[model samples]
Target: MISRVTQQTVQKSTLANLQLNLSRMSDLQGRLSGGKLITKPSDDPGGTASALQLRASQRAAEQVARNVDNGIGWLGTVDSALQTSLDSLRRARDLTVQGANGSMSAQARDAIAVEIEGIRSAMLSEANTSFLGRSVFAGTSNTGVAFAPDYTHQGAPGSSVERRISSDATVRVDVDGSAVYGQGPWDPVTATGSVFGLLDQIAADLRAGLPISDHIAHLDTRRDSMLGELGAVGSRYGRLETVQQGVQKTIMDLKGQVSAIEDIDLAETMVELQSQEVAYQAALGATARVLQPSLLDFLR
Candidate 1:
């Protein structure tokens, strides 16, 4: 025997179909408004997870780029100070050469010594140069001055300031002042004579009419050390620039990946929305026609 269909079952089926069509339309409208496929994790769990991961990676790359910029600034400050110090040392060397000439009178030698002293003072100031309120050549020391008042190195030795430019890389942004200027107490016997001490001794020799050949050699050595440090600073600056470029590119790529995972296809979504609208209207019309007549009409 065949089972008889009831009007109540027919009405229930129509209501369920209508509800499903309305839900589909609502979801399409939401995607259109938001312009993204993954409005919530439930929309597309795998795609939402990928988007979150990419967003996190993008943020980290941006932070690393900022660190690279700060590193570049610190290295630039150090390079500028070293340049000024190098110039002052060269000037002091020129005066020393002139003072060493036997043809120069005592008064003339005294005048040269005075100028050399000024150069030495200026070099000391450069050594104590600071960037962002911290000594650039003082390693990790937060002291405002890299060198003490007595021409002694005041910055921490063997400690460097480093900035993380990438996941696997850290770059040193500071120089070791003690290595370039020698240690404090400026010992001549211990081979730790600073440029300041060397200039002071040269000034004394000029006044006493003593030979300054050894002093000239020491001056050259200090100048060489300064040059080496300057070169290292330039190298680090160049490396930071390269890292900055790489980070910028990584950020761009990560953003693209996130967009692909999270952003909606407007054209395709619009087409699907129009199709759903047509189907929903068709279902409503069919339900209206099918439910128009009832059991009362059949009894009449």
Candidate 2:
């Protein structure tokens, strides 16, 4: 059977082909202008899904980087406070040693006591140090000060503040003030005693002209504790730094991946756009010729 070709079929086919060519040209131009290979899901469903996933990963990595930066700042504040506390303790220890000397007169001991009192005040201030208006050594306590003026601990105990630096990694950013300063004045009676209590005892003994040998030993022990904390803070700070570096690298890598998935190559896009323009022009010419012949046949 011989099939008759109609003018209607030729006109419809020409219009459809021209529309497709125009659509392709529009898409290429959009890609070139937007600098994105996939502006819509219909453009490339698989590639759109991949780009969305990569964008989500990039956003998450950026958030992690921010968390790492905040953690670093918190740890830095802690490290600085601990260093100051250590210095105060060392100075107190030096005074205690000097006060232990029998050759020192009562007036001299009194002066040492005054200086020790000042050091105690300074240590208390350090213990109450705040970072971003929150106590750095107070765990999650919402109190403005970690330690009260009466040497009472106002912060919560045994709580940890942590920051997520990556998808699978978290790091602690706070230290326990009670561990460093004892349970404030409520601390149990011990050989070394609470940090504040030890300083008070040392000052009292110096003022009373009493033997400070045990007090000296306690001071040394407290100093050792402070040194240990300083070491721990330093270790945590170093870990944060390392984690920050890794997070930064991950962010960069994620950005690159997102770019690969979503961003267009300018040169390639320009070449494709030119090719589509040429094809669209040829389609327009072909459509005109096809439609003219169909119109003549329809007239006949």
Candidate 3:
């Protein structure tokens, strides 16, 4: 069909083309300046969703990383305390053996008793070891110390401190103080299963000039308990170390994914921006030539 081509229609068409070109240039400039492919969600809906999901995951991983660091600190303190306690028990054993000797004089026995008292103090100190003011052996209890002066356990029976290493896994950072150090008098019925109770028994025997071969056996049993806990702590520490590596690697991978999805490729954007600028300028020149000048142009 034949149609009339009016001047106003031509002018409107030219203005629309110029506006479209200017909008394109503006978008490219925004991307270049912001250095992001998706400044607003409208830019790319699917990519924005993916980027948001990846960022949430990254934050979770970062929190797990913090938990790992705290867990390592707690476990390291526990392991070292257990080792030191074991050494103290060994020394106590040697002293017990010396005290059990038939030829040792009364004065010598008394002196050995004094030394055994010192070992007991040292072991108690180790049992109460802490990480950032919280007892490592306290099993989630906020009692501030694992064992009281009377050798009674202060930690909760089964409750423990734990740290999350991943979305699916958590590791216990605190140990069972009652199991490792003995509750009250250790074996309450015997009044002498706890390390402190046993040490007390040894000291009494030494002062009374009584044979203490049994004390040495008791020390061995307590030492074995310390060794078992130490082994367990070591295993957990190794696990945390491995998990930390995985978490760190996962965080790095998540960052790369997000960057790919959201970050602009500067080189590509620069080239596109230059092209858009050229197109916009050409559109402006073309529009100026096609449209007839108004009365304002005549007055000017």
Candidate 4:
């Protein structure tokens, strides 16, 4: 049999080990309640690495969603400006038709010319549309205005803006400004020529007492061409809406994936925590009985 001193030492050692285990159990309880797998680097290196990667991916996806939102804003602005331009063009066309009746006096035509000049200035302002300090139609020059103050456009001929929606997917966020406003199918409006310019020229001829029906007919052709350009841009806006819907779906999918990776299964974690608490209580009861013997009992 061990001496009393030896037995006492054994109990002290057992109590020290039990205290250490209880401290560990308390730490686990806190972590389980908090619903996190690891609180420190020493607790779980691999899990921490995986969690960081998931967070990064989630952040990147959110930024792409923001990019899509900004693109939508820009498209809406362009669409609005185009709608205004179309209305002004139609109104100007109507005025020209009325003025060509030959019975209208020069003063009456001059009044119409004044209104057309206003529409010209309005169109020039629309061409310079902006969003968040950047010109929506400026091609690649983020720092430059889309249209010069004199109604001229500048940028890469067909530069495109793109956003990375996913690790493997990229989507065009903007239509090329040159494609929409400067050249190609709608090139009749010179980069330097304001829609106002044509209207002003017609107004000047009418005021100068020239017969203007043929000139009005030519202006009609340009008006129709501008309408066609508006239609194309409207189609592009519709396509962007479609792309935005797809992006929303992708964001939902990515959120689901990140939740799967980072969120603890609450039901499972609660069950394990309860079971561990019960086991710890049972261990405490057993340890109390074992550690409760007195030095007097050993002497007797």
lDDT of 2 at 243: 77
Candidate 2 Cα errors over 4 Å, as ranges: 1-9, 166-169, 185-192, 288-300
Whole-model lDDT values for every prediction: 0.87, 0.82, 0.87, 0.66
lDDT of 2 at 213: 74
Counting clashing residue pairs in each candidate, in order, gives 0, 0, 1, 0
Give lDDT tens digits, candidate 2, residues 1-300.
988888788889889988998888888888888988888888789888887887888788788878878888988888888888888888898889899998899999999999998988888888888888999878899988887777777777568899987668788888888778775442225553368877887888899999887676676776777678778878877887887788788878888887887889999888888898898899889888877764468689
Model 1, 1-300: lDDT tens digits are 998888878888998998899999999999999998888899888888888888999999999998999999899998998999998998888888888798888999889888988887888888888888999878888778888877777777679999998678899999998888875544657646778888888888898888776677888999999999999899999999998998999999998899888888899999999999999999899789768887788999
Tens-digit per-residue lDDT, 3-76, candidate 3: 99877888899999999998988988888888888989999999999999999999999999999999999999
Q: List the residue pairs that clash in candidate 1.
A: none
- Highest TM-score: which candidate? 3
Evaluate model 1: give its TM-score. 0.85
Sort the candidates on lDDT, descending order. 3, 1, 2, 4
Model 3 TM-score relative to the real fold: 0.90
Worst 10 residues of 3 by lDDT: 183-192
Greater-lDDT candidate between 2 and 3: 3
TM-score winner, 3 or 4: 3
Quantify how close model 4 is to the true structure by its C-alpha RMSD in Å.
Answer: 4.5
Model 4 CA lDDT for position 286:
63
